[model samples]
Target: MRIAIDAMGGDFGPRVVIPACIDALTRHPHLSLTLVGQQDEISAYIPSAERQQFADRLTVLHADKVIGNTDKPSHALRQRKQTSMHEALCLVADGHAQACVSAGNTGALMALSRFVLKMLPGIDRPAIITAIPSRKGDSYMLDLGANVDCSAEHLLQFAIMGSVMTQAVAGIAEPKVGLLNVGEEEIKGNEQVKLASRLIKEHGGINYAGFIEGDDICAGKVDVVVCDGFVGNIALKSSEGVARLIGRQLRDGFSGSVFRRLLGWLVKPVLQDIASYIDPARRNGASLLGLQGIVVKSHGGADRQCFGYAIDQAVAEVSMDVPNCINRQLEKSIAIKYRLKRSP
Candidate 1:
């Protein structure tokens, strides 16, 4: 499968994106890339000799324009159809490529994806599903800043999508789903959470595991966490901040004393492994679910390693055929719901 890269989207633009493509190609020999950006800018990033060696696999599509970070999502697409990111999404929508990856403006990416690729059947809104690392493994979080305010039905749909994703990507046979809430009881949380809980419980197809509070996130109590975009985004950022603080404390504690320093040296490798697993940049990208095509969103500030991981994620998503699985499950759900509604 050919993956399209928005070579001009991120802060570093082609400087980071071009090398990421090379890195991905090095790791996965079967993978091919269609780099979208200004020809001159993209070519400058590739070495003459190396480009010749990978000439058969790499192709560049020139997109002279660019969408800035501050560009309004509503107007940017119409204003800049030739922009690198816009053109990359267009490639996926038009079947020029299997998937598109970008580290540009998150809002614009979602808006453009919805406008271009459109939503899948039975899907009201497209959600951003991010894989958050946990002690057991990686857990999926949904609606991460995609739909700020979601109805109970929307949350239910996110649960369905998240469960399907975790199963396909994380290799779980029947992934457990959790609703992010303030307390673990069935009656806890605000009106939205309560209503969502009712809907989730009534929708028996999903593997609903009841309410999951903030502390349960890292504990890996559930495989997928569903919440409105606002709450999900807040929880994601807060967790990132706490991880950084803990890393800093560990660093200071290790360096402050001779005895501590000796012990730290012995355990430094293990601590570093844990820190690397939880680092935001290592897990910064998200998959845009419910679209007609696959689109992965990376952090705007993502460095080379982060971009590389995002490419790996795109590969895995395509290999698993996540969009097709989601579509089939949604069709089954709608059919079941319709039949239940018509019954006496």
Candidate 2:
């Protein structure tokens, strides 16, 4: 499958993204990538030998402009054309590529994706969903800064989409779905949460695990967690902060004292295992669910390996035909009939 990369979107631009594209090509020989960005800069990062070798597999699509971090989403949509980010998504929409990967401004990507690719049948708005590493496993969460204000019906849609995603990507037969709430009790949340709970529970096909507290998210009890963009974004940021804090504290504790340093050397292998388990790089890509085509967002600060994981995510979703899976499941469950036009 061919995946388009917005090589100019991330923090390091082509310096990081171009190398990651080469790495992905090396890993998946069948995979072809088209890097969209300033022609000269993108080409400069690629060595002559590897370029000649993968010439047929790797193509560069020159995009003169780039969407900057400070640009507003609305302005980016209205003004930025033929930009790396916009052109990348257009490749997916135009069927030139199966999926698109970008480490650009999240809001701009969302707006451009919605406008260019449109939304699938029965999906009102596109939701950003990503795997959050947990003790049990990775629990998928949705609406990560996509639609801050959502209705009960939106939450229900997020639930179905998240469930279908986990099943398809994670290969779980019947992934347990949960509604994020202040408390697990039925009486704890706002009106929308209560209504959403009833709707998801009433959907029948989804494995609704009822309301889940914030702590339950990482406890590994539930497979998919559903919430509004406001809540999901906050949870994502907070978790990231906590992950950094844990890593810092662990390093300081292990290396601060002479005795601890000796002990740390003894348990270095164990710490490596723990670090591998909790590494944020392992969970770098966040899928933009509900779009007509697959769009994977990489963190702007992500390195080559982390960005490659985002590309891998897009490849996996393309192989599984995620949009259709979600649509099929939505039709099967027919949760809260949405009066919207279907985009192909």
Best by TM-score: 1
Cα distance off (Å), candidate 2, residue 87? 0.9
Q: lDDT tens string, model 2, 94-203? A: 99999999999999999999999999988899999999988888999998999999999999999999999999999999999999999999988899999999989877
User: lDDT tens digits, residues 1-344, model 1?
Assistant: 89999999888998998888898999999899999989998999999876998898899999989888888898776876788888999999898899999999888999999988999998999999898888778889988899999999899999989998888988999999999999998778888889999888877778999999988887899999999999999999999999899899999989977999999999999999988988888886799999999999988889988999899999999999999999988988888888879999
Q: Alpha-carbon error at 336 in model 2, in Å?
A: 8.8
Collision count for each candidate, in order: 0, 0
lDDT of 1: 0.90
lDDT agreement of model 2 with the native: 0.92
Best by lDDT: 2
Off by over 4 Å in 2: 335-344
- Cα lDDT, model 2, residue 207: 94
